[model samples]
Target: ENKAMESRLRQAGFPYVRTLEDFDFAFQAAISKRHIQQLTTMQWIDDAFNVFFLGPPGTGKTHLSVAIGGAAVDKGYKVRFISMDQLVSAFRTESTDPKAHRALRAIRKADLVIIDELGFLPITRTEANQFFQLVNDLYQRTSIIITSNKSFEEW
Candidate 1:
């Protein structure tokens, strides 16, 4: 059972395997290790609360988000990690296409999804609408960890 679970996690398509232990709190002093530890417990996921990691480049926002998502996966929850570009590309590829449906279905089924680099790419208003639709669909049903370089005010 343990082996199978490991295999499942391996195939879950994490951007990269990042763990809380691997994160360098010394380098990123602004981030609170205690907060990260609390997040690792994934209580937010149980309550379907979204986690937003907003910081400038090289601040380790991605590291924290991935670490948290990895924690969820380790606890036997399904997780999917993708960049903002990949998400927009998937949505812009033809709304009724099989690929789009597959992406939506995958997000729907995941217990936690890590959307990394959420403002790195330029998306059209239409694509933004579609993305919001996905967010709306997942609201209160699945948890998401969003890593963005932009602040909430910018968003």
Candidate 2:
């Protein structure tokens, strides 16, 4: 049992992996120092960090995001994966005031929430506000991994 715990911790990567020998520098470039710093801090207390991956199509955004989330899960984090469309759709379906709040609460409960394919479709103003609220709720509290085909300026 002790060895199992140690093995899981080693699989978490990060401090266990001394160098980025296996990580792609290109993917590393996509990630910002602030996010890395936040992750480092989170390592201290089992907290999580928020990260955004924005670039053109086929830029390996999804791959890197998944890798990070996988690493977090290996480290024993409760990770939730969903596309932006799914998030919007889920909230749109339960347009009731109470259900919307419930969805928001669900998002807040995750240790890591990953949203992929953002900006794939046009979002209504209200949806945008709700999405922003979700972001704000998770901001600094839990980790978020966002991947988008559009550049930051376009977003």
lDDT of each: 0.83, 0.66
* Per-residue accuracy of model 1 over 1-155 as CA lDDT, tens digit each: 78867875775667677788988899988888998899878889999999899989999888787778777877888888888888887887645688766866787888898888988777889888988998998999899889999988877
Q: How far is 118's C-alpha from truth in model 1 (Å)?
A: 1.0
**Looking at model 2, which ten-residue stretch has the lowest summed lDDT?**
12-21
| Model 1 segments more than 4 A misplaced | 94-100
RMSD of each: 1.6, 6.7
Per-candidate TM equals 0.92, 0.67
Looking at model 2, residue 59 earns an lDDT score of 64
lDDT at position 106, candidate 1: 86
